[model samples]
Target: MLGERVKKLTKLMLTGLTMALCVVAFSPTVKAEAAMLQESEPNDNPAQANQLPLNTWVKGKMDDEYDYDVDWYQFTIPKRGVSQIEMIPDSTNTSGAGWEVSVQDVNRHEMLQISGRTAESYKLGLAPGKYYMKVSGIHQTFVDNTHPYNLRINYSESEEWEIEQYYENKNFSNANNILPNKKYTGNMYSERDVDYYRVKINGKQ
Candidate 1:
């Protein structure tokens, strides 16, 4: 009788342990948000821009209005990915000139630009390289230094994701040189949007 009781107790303990593990395994988990980063000084140009993280909030301020302070931030992607940039400005503002924010290439070529009130957003599709995020007081008119602005950047890594050709690629002006044994991904934006791709070979024929 004691042997049977001991066997039952062992089985009960095992069952209870299994049930506890199941509860823990199926428990809900909250994802931690990225940390907030402060904008550094002397980031007026891309050469001296602050390092921007992939997914983080950067608080910026135009400290010297007389100097026409320009805050520039730079970020680099290891692989092909899309970056979502959100520029949040002070809503309760009376200034006509808010801020001119842009993402530029290494050569200072503007990839995209955003200028408006509240939270302005832009989605950028880029290959692996260094990019710049410029928040400048260098404007035609005066920029609002009284109201501080916030910038948040989020990147979607797609090194393994295949470039889905959902829509037909009609344009081939910007030819893409793809590498072998590697996956490439690009956004077609929407159903109405189009994509372009090309493979060039320089073999002696």
Candidate 2:
């Protein structure tokens, strides 16, 4: 009889210890999982805080001419940021001697001149507000081919970099201020009624 009683007492103590361990293992007060969940909330909308100001773009087409000046390409940014400008040739179009891009700061009277091939781009980081991209056709007028050119201008602070590229020909040197291998696929021309390059403002994230 004493042996049986001892066995029963030992079983009861083991059962009690097991229950105590289970309670400690799954305690409600020590919620490690819930604490971890709270940590993920802060970074959810980190990009929303860096939103860039609104921007507009204007596009224009140039016909065969020695100096097809585009003085009307202008706009104002509500805030200062980066500007990406491209003088792309219409995919369905062709150029005889290619086009040239230039800029003149309204206040400083400074000028930047760059020549572009069939699909080339020029990017500039400038202060906010009014600026101009004075585009014209290059004069290899000796070539008897009709040239039609297109332009694209994008402005944004959220973009990774302000860059330009060209790929119509196989020239791969950075001599023309062109960023190598940055390919672009978009509407080459924005209709005849469109008279200026298009600008886009990217949101910060």
Candidate 3:
């Protein structure tokens, strides 16, 4: 009788321990869901711009139930250079609807806007400072809250160099030789003007 009692006690203890472990493992999932629900609200202004990290993609949604819903993201340029901003919609909903992605300065002045369901990137020279990005539905009645989109920002340092016009080397045969990994800025003197540049590669890049 004691042996049977011991076996039953051991089985009961093991079952209770397994249940406790399951609860601990699943608790984080419940908390994450709650956090996402909280983040889905009140993101519609520059003042409430969600701070985003550079070069990282973030997911967001636009609620169709709301007439006007905009998601704002804020990022800072470490230094003056060319920054690329990408807005890509969910692949499943690309054919169904569209969204408008716009970039604005810190003062809320519009800089650029692109509208479509396809992925697009904007390369612009920006000063080292903070900027705001807004993403909204193209049409108020057609927005789909079930679909999610992504946003990313990348920056590359600018190299300053000058290229004078009317140089002796104007043709491809006499192309003005340039060094690798350099940025050159020049202007076209007339509408019927062309500039040729060549770079010598020593080996496989």
Which has the greatest TM-score? Answer: 1
- Per-residue lDDT of candidate 3, residues 110-163 (tens digit): 555677765565566555678889988777435445556777777766643223
TM-score of each: 0.58, 0.41, 0.56
User: In terms of TM-score, how similar is model 2 to the real structure?
Assistant: 0.41
Candidate 3 clashes between residue pairs 3 or more apart in a chain or in different chains: none
| Model 3, runs deviating above 4 Å | 1-40, 91-95, 140-143, 160-182, 185-205
Runs in model 1 lying further than 4 Å from the true structure: 1-35, 90-97, 138-145, 159-174, 177-195, 199-205
Full candidate order by lDDT, most accurate first: 1, 3, 2
Pick the winner on lDDT between candidates 1 and 2: 1
Candidate 1 lDDT, 1-205, residue by residue in tens = 9999999999999999999998877777734666668787778777798998887777777776563777889888777666777876644444554667887777775666677544455555665788888886535544445556778778887644323322333356544557665666665545475666565666699
Each candidate's lDDT (Cα)? 0.67, 0.44, 0.67
Per-residue lDDT of candidate 2, residues 1-205 (tens digit): 9999999999999999999999998998866632101111111122211122234222344433445333334445444345555555555464445666655454424334567565444344444555555555666632434444555556665223322212221133322232344532222221221111234345697
User: Residue 123 in model 2: shift from native, Å?
Assistant: 4.2
- Model 3, residue 52: displacement in angstroms? 1.1
Candidate order, TM-score descending: 1, 3, 2
